[model samples]
Target chain A: MATIMMRVRQIAGIALYLGLANAQEASWRSPVNVLSRKGLVADQISTIWWFLFSTASLVFLVVITLLLIALFKKGQAVPKGPVQENSSVRPILYLGTGLTIIVLLITAVYTFISMRTLAAPSQKPALTFEIVGKQWWWDVRYEGESISANELHIPSGEPVHFSLHSDNVIHSFWLPDLAGKRDLIPGHPNSLWLQADEPGTYRGSCAEFCGVQHGKMNFTVIAEPRAAFETWLEHARAEANAAVSEEARVGQAIFMQQGCAGCHSIRGTAAQGEIGPELTHLSSRLTLAAANIPNTTGHLAAWIVDSQSIKPGNRMPSQKLSGEDLQFLLSYLMELN
Target chain B: MFRGALIIAGLAVILHIGVILISLERVKAKPPLAMPDTTGRVVSQEASSLLKHYGCGGCHYIPGIAGANGKVGPGLEQFANRAYIAGHLPNTPENLVHWLMNPQRLEPGTAMPTMNLTSTEAKLIAGFLYGYDNDAR
Candidate 1:
């Protein structure tokens, strides 16, 4: 009997663990849901939102009840005739006005208190990243470090600072589940603090109406444990892996010679152009073209050959490469882990 | 009846002038092309229109182009008088044409992009720049 009881307990524990793991995975996939906040700043914001929502709902319910009473109550019906100076009418007006003032005052105080808490992080940020907004992509980097595009990584349970700037037009940095929207204006840098309570992935996007591809300007933030984040940073800082196979080697040569090097950069190689995103560790990223599409082999090839069809009016013109050369280039790019 | 006719005619004239002025403001002038000068360079207005079409005014401030007051790149007020194209290549017409066609070839890491201009388009743009410079002088 004792052994059977222990076995049953073990099975229950395993089931509970699986349930929690499934819940965590599901929450990450819920994109930009403000109420499902996973960060410190977002927690505060959602608290305020819930407070306001409930208060407003209560007010609405009360108002509707009063309206129904006024409409249907037989003896208490408001007089349609003007200047009757009814005793009941005067008291209702005063009561309604007083209640509105009191509710407004309470809401104002609650909102101000909640807003003040968001001004600074609970703890000092261990890492600060400079996030630059371009025409349709995000450039994430630390000072004097290697650059990554459209994806950000931060350690959970601690604050992360971000200094935002725009290279061209005004763009807004908004991670709805983590923090509020902050504008990145050219010639004017802005700063924000965000913290994730748990390790998960959150979707972020440009909130401002920038240009044609504004809707497609999306990014992902991956929150991990401190040790895992450190490992990632070390790997990302290193140069790209060298092409090994013969086809990949030929692809690397074609990339250098065929004007691809003119726009993109692959560190430790001759392709040092900085006009577009760095391609040093392209294979490791989750998405492509500012998170417009999945980072798959087929999508990468389509993007290379005809990026305009995927995203019209973007800066990358469709390349006219031979089928063999394209295959080779794809192989080489895939090796950039 | 005569007085009403005169008033209607005056109002029509004023409306016509207003329409013409509004159109002039809305559409930047696409003037006719001028003949090739002594230097064998053909001055084409189509090239000036092309500058607007390609949104070059979003970066470079070309003279005499309306709404071309972008502060990203240096102003092209006297482009012909510049000694070097992109501060490196000599400012000859042939070199300028080549630079326009393939800027990355000349300078590997320039912020100026390779716009994939055909040879003819590059020549026309070069002609316009030189012609505008001459006019400014």
Candidate 2:
């Protein structure tokens, strides 16, 4: 029996080690990463989570203790029958009810405080932006600027107010490390505010199910210093830089001549199709196809050649182009920044 | 209870068989149509990528290309035999190349958008399409 017990302990230790190793290999996409807070809202959310956890744990312990006591004392009761006054049971019932009521009241107060804190607008002038939730992508536009897709940039230590809209169905925008979820409904505009305390990249996803590709509808929130953000904004507002190389010029010519102009738009060029995302500063983005893959030259070539293979059922169709044409197009796109 | 279980089991088997038979019948009921054979022409290896770049599969059904199953426009299985381009222009190599390069200039308000293909790119795609003609001897 002792040998068997030792073997069980060794097995348990191995299992625990394997579990830890697996957890370490988990990517940023995992929900387990939500424990790290980066913004003011997430801080409050974490506090609330701890409070609820402790309260529930205490209640569970108390209930389990009472149950165990009752079960063990079942045979030890005196033979006084129905005539005896059960004073002990009455006090326990009163205690349980009183504790439950107090816990509920505390929870209610916490929820009220958190909601008010979230709803209160920042006193300092917050940067205003609009984000439209499409079928499986987020169309983001800074105030009075051309639109971009899948990436949201904000200044650190400053509040940013977002006006959210939906073009087709309802989608809930959620940046777990920055703020809670907000629903974007068609014909109804909702507003949300977030203030990141640090300059870092936070990933977000469409929390609500919209369609077949809802799981793939991910985005990134980049928080930088005020100076850097302003510089980025200026760059975003500028027209596409002229192609400096011959290959890029050929690629630009192909982009304009092809049906790409029908769905995508690149400012300062004749390619003005509103069906897809704006591509004035396409190369500056970190990821493509709504964070499906890193924005590399190879990924760009593959995406341009066959976007359906990268993100199936997406609105962007595959383009049949020769290798030389694809190289030129890739060069042109990479130079957009 | 034993008899009731037997009846339920028997009914479930019958229902499962009925569903399979119905599905088989539906699959067999599709009508077959006489499709033209366009296997004679040599398709350029680069034509597939060019076709994808132009997004031709988004509107027309092109055979032998993945994701070319769009139904927005007419299928291009035997396009070589078609006498006119876009139902009006005469079906010549020059006309096809011209139509590929400038769809809007030839016919404004047409559903097909102008896919600015260069002359060389357009000629290559046209060649690949024309090579698939079944009637060509």
Candidate 3:
């Protein structure tokens, strides 16, 4: 018996260690993990979650213990005509009800306090970003100047303001690790203020069912130091670089001649169209097609040839171009950085 | 009572099948737009296919085309009936072909883009637009 107990203890230890290791490695990076918080707003919410969880767990333990005791402790069966409560069970019932009420009142008060804390930021926001939720993508702008798509950059350890707008339909912006969901209604703007305590990348997505590609509509929030973020913004505000390589020059010509210039825009060039996301710094973005795939040369080539296959029902049409022209186009796009 | 319930169930099955057949018939019916008459006018028929191939339906609501319900641009249901192209140029066959070729040159800063349409393709599209109007009348 002693040996069996020792074996069980060793197995339990290994299970606990594996569980903790998995939580630390994977759960912190998951956007929906409310417990692994990196922002001030998320921290407050986590506190509330922990409070409610602990209280509810204690109540569960007490109830389960009583249930087990009642099951084991055999007693004379009560007559079954009219339900009669025994005097012994009366005390247990009163104790259970009283404990339940106290837990409920505490949780209610805690939730109210957290809600008030989450209502506003502690300090004035140092930066403001205007985000327009387009169909299957996000258009991010800083002070109405530098424009980017599907990526938002901000300085860590400071409150950052966001003004959300929808170009077509209603979409809900949700980055669970940084803040709660905020709806972006067309013609009706909504504002949110969030602050990250540390420098990290938080993934966000459209929570509302806007259209067919709602699940593919994802964005990234990159938090960095103040100086680095400012430097990055300055670069993002500039226009595209002039075509340097011979292939890139051919690619630029193809971009203008083909229908690619019809719906997309690249600043510093004459390819201005408001129908699709701007590709002024196409090479700099971390992902493509609203974070559905990584931004790689091969992936980009596949996307340019047939974006419909990558994301069905999207706005970008499949291009009909020769292999050489496509290579030239890819070269020019890579030089935009 | 069981017999009555069985009779009602039988009637419900028949009604469901009837509704499905009617809906299938409606789905098979042709759209309410005049197609380009394919009588020796091969360019117009090819132009209609080109419009779908170029994904024009992704932006404009062109009639007689399946899945062309886009709301970004104005509907092209009665293209030949419009007095002016893009609200300025007089609607003519030649003018329409030019607009289709170089939309940016005619109206600078216009949302209409200069696609990679050849002169022949532009003329074909114009012919199809006029042919559709004549067939409709």
Candidate 4:
């Protein structure tokens, strides 16, 4: 008993320490995940959804109970045909059908009303990011500002908003653990938002039938300590002015000579092509080739050589560079961040 | 009852096949050349240069046009082969002309704005685009 008590005390102390560390001082504080939304209207809708779910469960339980009772009254040897109920079956039938219809009608009304109320006057967005989803990729641009995909590098604790749209075909922006799904239509922009609760990698995907390579569409909401992100920003700024070493300079020259900049932008150079992915912070990203391939030197080179092998139908073409040229380009691309 | 069940099962199987067909992304029929579709229209380098002047791909999808894969509009790969122009308009030159003139006349909620093309320019573009095909430039 004494040993168990001592162990309990120690565990309690550790839990208390961890709880203090996890206090809401440096974490996201929106209640959308807490209980739907911090908004009054959203909270009400969420409450209604929970209520309907519970009510459906209750009705299911009652029906199941009656079904079990009816089944057990006779075993497997029971009558093979539908049994006629009591002579007063009309009332029960009418009531059962009426209740079912009523439940469905209420649910439909509640769903429509709540969805409609999402755009109410009180539901003004907190912040917004223009997320233009493409074939197996997403081009997120901050409102009236530029947000390079090389670093999802969002400011911590603030509501980083998202305005969703598609580039190639229909795609959906869904960060299930953080926010909801929004459809990206061509020539049409839909809006959504999320405040990452903590500094971690929140994965999202394209939830619509985009094309042959729709399954590979994946993005991450990477939140970090504000100061750390600030350091990253400074590093990104310096990358534009990133001095080219002799080897990298030769590689940069190769990039230019090989016409890489014609289809890709390198920020502070003449290669202002917008057809390909931005190599501004190409090395900083966790994945490459629209998150289809892992970001390793060999993989990057392989992707540059034959991207179609990995992501079958992406827009970038397979370049047949010699081994030396491929080595040189890889060196240059790795220095982008 | 057994016959009824068989018929229902067969119908379900047919429906399943139809769904599988719909879900399968149909292979886009590539043209033999970069010329337009059903019509044998071909765009010139000068006329291609006119693409930039007009910014045709700004709100439309046109493969190989300069700054073509922009996010503002749908990408053009099988545009001419599409059965409908907008959401519901028929795929015909005159119908397309009517749509290009005023889209609201066709689909009330279309996001594509009327480009107001001249009869000559429209016919030329229609002919050239109708012939676009499978070969990569």
RMSD of each: 19.8, 14.0, 17.1, 22.5
Model 1 lDDT at residue A191 = 98
Q: How does candidate 3 fare on TM-score?
A: 0.63
Tens digits of per-residue lDDT for model 2, B25-97: 4212111112232122222434544574456765567764555655546788777778898889999888988
Tell me the lDDT of model 2 at B118: 78
DockQ of each: 0.01, 0.02, 0.01, 0.01
Ranking by lDDT: 1, 3, 2, 4
Q: What number of clashing residue pairs does each candidate have, in the order they appear?
A: 0, 11, 0, 15
Query: What DockQ would candidate 3 receive versus the native complex?
Result: 0.01
Per-residue alpha-carbon lDDT of candidate 3 for residues B1-137, written as tens digits (9 for 90 to 100): 99999999999999997886654432231122233333343343355545644455544666544445544457776677889988899998778889988776787655454565777767766665655455432
**lDDT (Cα, tens digit) per residue for candidate 2, span A78-128:** 675567766766988888899999999999999999889877655654688
Quality class of the docking in candidate 1, CAPRI style: incorrect
Candidate 4 on A137-206: residue-level lDDT in tens?
Answer: 8775655434465236655565566777766688998765555577999888887655554676555678
- Per-residue C-alpha lDDT of model 3 across residues A1-337, encoded as one tens digit per residue: 3444544554454344434433322222233566667888888878778887888888899899999998999778778699865686788888889988888888888878888888889798978899889998998887775378888678999999999998799999988888888999998999999998898777888999999999899988889999999988888888888999997999999999998888888989999987788999998877778976556554566578767766789999877776567777877888888
TM-score of chain A of each: 0.88, 0.85, 0.86, 0.73
- Model 2 TM-score, 2 decimals: 0.63
Shift of residue A62 alpha carbon in model 1, Å:
0.6
Runs off by more than 4 Å, candidate 3: A1-32, A80-88, B1-137
Best by lDDT: 1
Score residue A9 of candidate 2 by CA lDDT: 52
